[model samples]
Target chain A: DAGITQSPRHKVTETGTPVTLRCHQTENHRYMYWYRQDPGHGLRLIHYSYGVKDTDKGEVSDGYSVSRSKTEDFLLTLESATSSQTSVYFCAIRGLYGYTFGSGTRLTVV
Target chain B: GIQVEQSPPDLILQEGANSTLRCNFSDSVNNLQWFHQNPWGQLINLFYIPSGTKQNGRLSATTVATERYSLLYISSSQTTDSGVYFCAVPYQGGSEKLVFGKGTKLTVNP
Candidate 1:
């Protein structure tokens, strides 16, 4: 089992739909991040949470929102998903050595 | 905005070959990390070398904070090592946001 895991390993949703992706960590790391991976864009941060109830925007936070009601859970929600949002999303937590990532969630917005 | 550049966007090597991947940052950062994204799309933390050098098995990483560059070296590469290697640093000083480079794609053949 991974320390961090993302739900809905594969999702296909229609455009303009509201979708939520869950990231759960067994360890209570204070810092959590959501990033999307695309062909040419590499991995771009969508949002990051420094602490419970304290989240901030990243470079690519336009169509996404994040929440951390509890330390082990960081949620990423796409409001009115667009076709351009089709990408692989990864969740990670800052660890003593570095960031440990979860197996990505492949989301396709058709 | 700080710039993170990775060299040798693509690489190919025969089994047992050694390789070096480089990452250069435009400014200094408190945190620097190396990650490997496997063919299964699983992101694994390889190293967290802010400065100095660290080694693990056949892999090693060195970061020169003063020069704002890091290098990841892999020895005796195997076919299983074929994937993408990424280097990341804080988006800027005093921020927890991690910005990733475009990554270097590596292909190891038998």
Candidate 2:
């Protein structure tokens, strides 16, 4: 509940299709993060944004790209969806007290 | 990246039981956090204890930065407390990117 809201709570896409997830925050936080959670892998970072138009890759950045044109919006894109990309994606914002996470988006690639 | 290991990967406790979940890290961390992923796949931040101890209601967390470990205690647990508990710490370079452990799956039964 870090004032973060992720769109398309659940999505099912075909292989090779392009998919994008949006994370919007109202807190005007300086940092935003994208992470994917799988069965064995607790949670793996995909990308992060430090400021407007300032983004960096994370541990699992392959097949994913992020854009942050505004401080309140961060978008995660899968150029081409794959079966391995099916997982629950989470958006987090760094708060003064701690980090806050959204409800998450569940993506399924068929 | 710092390595995080959580003990008792799986734990089943009866209602009203008390449990301690441990998270051991391989390096010093500037931020340590505990999160509970609920049944609906929502991540709820429980604690952001970089060091020292903090308590909120039935949950308490302690992080020993010197020892590179953190502990979460749940008292009088209820069935709603059943979920995967994750402990995350930042990468060695002090980046906001977090490295998460596999997590401890706790099942509270009536």
Candidate 3:
């Protein structure tokens, strides 16, 4: 939580526009993750990176993609933002203590 | 992938009260962590207990891996404790990728 930072704490975008959320970590943790939280679904994983340039899709990855070119940064992109994709997104890093999370980005699509 | 279910989906408690939250997984897991998402959407790590028990301040956690369940206890709750509690587990293999439960929302009133 202390080392991880999520950009644009709040964003309002058009339904068809593309959106990219950035996650930067000061801690050099190798594993990074992106997740979205909704009312009924709770938190669902979007994607994760085990190392720089090594990423994998999660259960709810269909509308999302991620890139990790550096150990300190993981970016989540929505190719085409949809109203349904409007939710709070969180970034996390695997640390010695456990998974440390970011403050989260609140995105709204209209 | 393991399935995580948290009980008492919504809880209300008076200040200084105590409560117990339960998490039941569909399978055995050696990696588990508890998180608290505050009203501001900041997720804070509470415990990284995979098994056994651990206590911090007024919060304690116990995980019985063999029984595929974990319990989180909060004592002397305060209004600041109002938030959503989550328990997450490894998705598969030994990866840090996690699958989270829907969450248990707690509202502590003064």
Candidate 1 vs candidate 3, DockQ winner? 1
Clashing pairs in 1: none
Q: What is the interface RMSD of candidate 1, in Å?
A: 0.6
Q: Where's the lowest-lDDT run of ten residues in candidate 1 chain B?
A: B90-99
lDDT (Cα, tens digit) per residue for candidate 3, span B1-110: 77899999999999999999999999878789999989888889999999999999999999999999999999999999999999999887676788899999999999
- Assess the local accuracy of residue B75 in candidate 2 as a C-alpha lDDT between 0 and 100: 99
lDDT of 3 by residue, A13-74 (tens): 99989999999999888889999988888888899999999999887998898998888999
Which portions of model 3 miss their true places by more than 4 Å?
none
The TM-score of candidate 2's chain A against the true chain A comes to 0.98
Clashes of each: 0, 0, 0
lDDT by residue (B1-110, candidate 2, tens digit) is 68999998999999999999999999989999999988888889899999999999999999999998999999999999999999999887677888899999999999
Superposed Cα deviation of residue A32, candidate 2 (Å): 0.2
DockQ-sorted candidate list, best first: 1, 3, 2
- RMSD in Å for candidate 3, one decimal? 1.1
Model 3 chain A: lowest-lDDT 10 consecutive positions: A1-10
Task: Please write out the lDDT profile of model 1 over residues A40-100, one tens digit for every residue.
Answer: 9999999999999999998899999999999999999999999999999999998887889
CA lDDT of each candidate? 0.94, 0.94, 0.92
Candidate 2 local lDDT, residue B61 = 96
True contacts kept of 3: 0.91
Where does model 1 sit among the CAPRI classes?
A: high
Evaluate every candidate with DockQ and list the scores: 0.94, 0.86, 0.88
Of the true interface contacts, each candidate retains a share of 0.97, 0.85, 0.91
- Which whole-number lDDT from 0 to 100 does residue B69 have in model 2? 94
